[model samples]
Target chain A: MTTLALPTTEEEIWRYSRIDELDLGAYSPQRCATQVVGDPAILVKSSGSNVLKHDDVFTQTNRDNSEAIVIRVPKSHAGGAVEIIHHFDTSGALYCPRVIIEAAENSEVSVVERFVSADGVKALVIPVLEVHAAQAARVSYLAVNELGATTWMIAHQEAEGERDSNLNLSVVALGGDYARVRTECRLIGQGASAQQVALYFADGTQMHDFRTTQEHVAPRTHSDLLFKGAVAGKSKSVYTGLIKIHPHARGSEAYQTNRNLTLSEGAWAESVPNLDIETNEVKCSHASTVGPIDDDQRFYLESRGIEPATAERLVVLGFFNEVLERLPNKVLATELYDRVVAKLAASETVGSE
Target chain B: MSVLEIRNLRASVAGKEILTGMNLTVRSGEVHAIMGPNGAGKSTFSAVLMGKRGYEVTSGSVELDGVDLLAMPTWQRAVAGLHLVMQYPTEVPGVHVDELIEQAWRTRGRSTTELADAVVAEAERINFDARLVQRAVNVDLSGGEKKRNETMQLALLKPKFAILDELDSGLDVDALRDCARRVEDATNEDSLGAIVVTHYARLLEDLKPDFVHILVKGRIVESGGPELADRLEADGYAAFSG
Candidate 1:
């Protein structure tokens, strides 16, 4: 089996990212042996017909890859959140684990995938998720990346939306050494819709980069993307999104928006939104904004007797709530909100000094 | 007896003074109306009372039952029994109206079951459709709908001291009357007082206030009984300015 070489800075995708800081030579790809410990509330196994058994994409990719894990969700199950915890205890190398989710027609499901390492373990992890939303199905996906401070992570999500299906994906990044995420979704059938939302907070010289694409190839399709993030402590984030509407995809509506809040003078954010629309009847727009939090909104919350820290948390939560609340599951929405708040609180405590 | 007392309260925004030495006393069970021309600092007074940031408090003090209001943050002030129905209520997109109202209620120490029941009953009293509770706060709402939503919040919160900043603006006559009636019904003899800020005197016709003060150039230029609204309607701010 041929091993896949780690990407270098010379690659276009890794240009602005700090890929050189990752020393893969010192580590070897090893399967996680630690007993994953977390409540079902925080982690759970997926239940459904194992679609990965018949056509496992990760099996084919893992021959030379270092990480491989399979998750299967069958059709027509009452949608609920499934949490998977990836624990890295010892310092070593890890390959991308493939997660596969299949939603049947009229079924609804939500999953929260969390990547966390053992305290102080300097590790490398690569994770990939593939989601298939069947015709008329609904799926909500959330990923929380909270690896060890010294660890490096590379993640990707590839999704396909079927006819009249609905797909929603959200990512929250709060830890890692150098993290990169590539998310892509294709609307392959008429009346399918996809929504992408992400929130990332980086600090302590860490770097986060995200690349996303929403390709609309079917007529009457819809897609919307909203990713908001904050950077502090000299950390940096780069977000690039593309919305493609094919020539025959008339009557389609698509929008892409990226908003970043920089809290420190040295913190930086780069946003690039691209649109390729070939149909005149389609309604499409892309917008990106990178700046500090709205002083007015912050002050408004503060004036309500909320302390500065509490006010900032509320504002940040509110900022992301614009997307979080859109999730179909109230329980999942509240859970995500609380987790994001906890992350913000943790950062504030660390930065207080 | 006085729930809120404002003495010589002066404020500014972007270096321009808006409220200059404004003095007012609101006792429990009293409804006061501050009617004035455009740019008379009516909204500015409400903003300052709520501790809206960026509005520099140059001088004077505002007290809620003798607690220095300027020292309190907006949410604390809210928790201290102060609620403001903004002239232009801001939209909190993707936030359900019920969730916000419930949060405010819970923050004020109401039990979850009690809050839910109270919210549902109050929402019904204001003729709010049950479906609206699930919608984003003030998103895609009409002028009258926004005003009613503010009243819904006031009913749910039931604060001791309330400020209605231009709450009568942009309402049709029926909606205006409905809003005024709701305000009258909501404010009672129980340690509850309100300061209604508006430019139109017609709103006061249905729910007569105990006192009327004409504000001009950041100061109370005229003070009188409910008749002051009628007098101003005939002569306008011309009689009170300067």
Candidate 2:
């Protein structure tokens, strides 16, 4: 294997990000030979034994050498959820994993992937996932990142939708030293639709960054994006999204929203939503808000005999509930709700202590 | 015995005094309606009882069945049998109506099996579809449906003392009639006491309260039997406000 060098600030995507702070020289790539162990409920495994591929596009600019792990779902297969679990336990190292999902025509599937790191390990991980939805197909994907506090993570997700196909993607980030996620969806076929939802919570000294793009290249397509996040302690987060409608993509409807709740004065959040519509008869709107919890709303809950801490928890959960309710799967929605509530509870406990 | 007693209660929000030395007493097995004009501190009174934040209780002593109600948290008050049917109940999205009611029921120490049975029975009484049980609480529900949902919550919680704040405001005629009957049935079945706050007598026509008190400018201006509702309906709150 040849050593690949990481990119610097000169690259357009790497600009405005602190990519040079990461030292990948001492980190070595190792195959994930160890079998995964955890509660099956939270783990996601591939359907068949397939040779997985790993690539680092930032280090190796050669797209030819980049390998892609493909998981195909047949059109006749019944639609259900698939879970993918990635566990990293290495110390003082960098890890990169690439994944690809292909949904056949008229099929429907949901994939949930979890990224976790062992305790006491200091590592950097950059993961890239690609998804292709064939004509009239439907695909829903969720990524949950829960790494150790000493770990740094940067992930990218690119999806392409075909004629009359639907794609829904969600990301939940709860742990990391400095985590950044970039997700893009391209509607390449007429009548295709895409929905994107993201929920993130950062506390202590954590920093989370998110950037997304919804590109409409065909006519009569639709897209909706909602990204909500909360910050506490001395944490910081940033969200930047773009909705681009091409000249030929007339009659496209697109909406983007980013809302942030700051729980502590020391915490900070920044949101930027942009739209570029080149054609007539296109409807596009973007909204971004960053503020603390509404005092009146919190008071209303507390007055109902809910304690201050519990009231805050309920309000925060209610804030995210608007987005979570949009998820199609009730069971998965409940599970995600529980996980977010647990995060809030842990923070409340720590704040109180 | 006195289920709730409020003495010289004075509360404020954002440094503005709203509840000015108000006083009230509610006994078990009795229904008291607090009628007032808009901004007479009726809603503020309910907020104060729920221990809502931001409303500073400048001076007051609230006791519930010999226990200090003011000292307990809001949920604790619910556990202690204090329920409030808010005028505008918050839409708790992503939470199923059944799940929320069940959680509230279990929080009151009811067994899971009992809670489930109670929810089903209450839903049936309100003519609520079994399918609505799985839907998010109050989200995208019609005004009438939201009111029924509130009543459903009241039935499930079975609070010993409840305060309904203008529950009839957004209800239609049929919904009002149904809600009134449900209230009558709930009170009769559990011998529960309640403070029914409203501006009109239509809701009280069927559920004839044991007493009706006219609340004016944060004070009870007049207290009488069911006839008071009829009188207020004819005369209106104008004369009472003066």
Candidate 3:
């Protein structure tokens, strides 16, 4: 049997990534239980066949050792949000959690997947999530990453929208020593639309990397993406996104925006946005920014009698508020906001010392 | 009464001297109008007083209530009762005015209930849109709305001294009168000392300054009663220019 080789940073897709530092030999396959909560009919442990593509070695490996779960929203049913929580407690373990969500025609559903690990655990987790929105259906998925400080996560997310369907994908990642997620959204049917929003914050030497693609394959399709992040301490973050319109996808519209704030001299952030159009009569734009907090914003809060550190905390929270406001779930948004605040408060303590 | 005194205040920006030996004194409940031509250090004076970065005060003494105002940080200066109504208030997206003011007030041990009441009261007093306090601070506010928002903040913060830097620059006839009236009421009711900086006589018609000083080449070259504003408005700053 031939050995499978891991990907390297030399590839364009992995540019500026920390994949070279990963050690696959140190980890062994282990099991982490998946707890399904809310709307029991919508989520189940099943042996459902996977329909999404295995684009890379990570997805293929996850499929080989998958703890698969299927979430199906019934036809014409409108239900509240369901949650899937995966808790990892073993040390030096490799765990792969796979999820497949399908919304029937005219159905509406929301799902939140949370990955959490025990403190001080050293492990590697690969999570694969596939979302399929049927004709005229609505699906909203939020993935929250709260892994341990010593854990590493490589996540793959694939979403597809059918005729007249709507899809929303949101990510709030503030955990793991090194976490990377690659999200791809495809609009395959006419009048299908998708919106993706994310808020990621890194501190205390942590790193978060995101790569996203918005592909329009049919006429009159639309997609919008907004991702914002903040880096403090010696932490770092990287975001690269692309908008692609196919040859026959005329009258398509796509917008991508990524903004980052580097809160410390040692922290770093990089944003790269690109657009490709194979057809005319399409509107597409991409914008990205990586910089320190605005001095004017800092002064504005400080002049209002807010202490410098407190002023910074407020500004950072305000920076993330844009994403929070756009979140589809208010309860989840509040929880995500609290996590960001905790991270900022932790970094503030480190800064004052 | 509290006093904000600037003695021989010489300041510079980008290594070039702007305010060369400027002096002024404003007491609580008193109004002082500072008129100057373009580049005569009108805005620089306000910036330096608020401890804004990049504005260097070479050799001068500024005392707020007999304390070394220059020795404190910008926020500390605000806590010590000094505020500048910025000419162009910064646009802070995603932060609401109510949240900002509430945070500022709560940090000083004030209750949120008081802030809520004060926000509504002040907004009404200044004819500001009460709903705007719920929106992002100055994000999409028009020029007139921005000035009104600043005026509302001035009333709520209640600083011991404020420098209205070109408060009338962007206001229409109606907005200018309304803002001037609100400020005048603040001065009379709260004893809020102010330094009204303007180039036109229209705003002074309602502000009614106690002293009008002509600032030329950084220093107050001439000082007189309210009539001085009329003379400068009629004769322009060309009389005092080099």
**Best candidate according to TM-score:** 3
CAPRI band for model 2:
acceptable
Listed in order, each prediction's TM-score against the native is 0.81, 0.85, 0.96
lDDT of 1 by residue, A1-353 (tens): 43455667686556677767766566677775423332233222543232222122223334346333333444666645566676766677665555667776777777777787755787777676778888888888878787767787877678888899999988878788778788888898899999998878788787889988898989999999888888877889999888988887889999998988887788899988888888899998888999877776555444333456655665666677776666555776687678777766776776777
For lDDT, candidate 1 versus 3, the one ahead is: 3
Q: How does residue A211 of candidate 2 score in lDDT? A: 83
Per-model B-chain TM-score: 0.96, 0.95, 0.97
Rank list by DockQ: 3, 1, 2
Q: lDDT scores for all predictions?
A: 0.76, 0.78, 0.88
**lDDT (tens digit, per residue) of candidate 3 on B1-242:** 89999999999899999999988999999999999888889999988998889999998899998999999889999888888888888998888899999887866667778788888988887778899999889999988888899999888888889899999977887777878888888888889899998877778998999999989889999999999888887788888775
Output the worst ten-in-a-row residue range by lDDT, candidate 3 chain A. A46-55
| Model 1 misplacement above 4 A | A1-12, A32-63, A66-86, A99-114, A129-146, A160-174, A188-192, A201-206, A231-235, A261-268, A291-309, A326-337, B64-67, B79-81, B93-113, B129-136
Higher-TM-score candidate among 2 and 3? 3
Model 3 agreement with the true structure over A33-127: per-residue lDDT tens digits: 77888887777677664556546778877888887888888899897568889998888899999988889899999988999996688889999
In the range A101-159, model 2's lDDT, one tens digit per residue, is 77879887777777888656787777777788889989898887788777888887788
Candidate 1 yields a Cα-based lDDT of 0.76
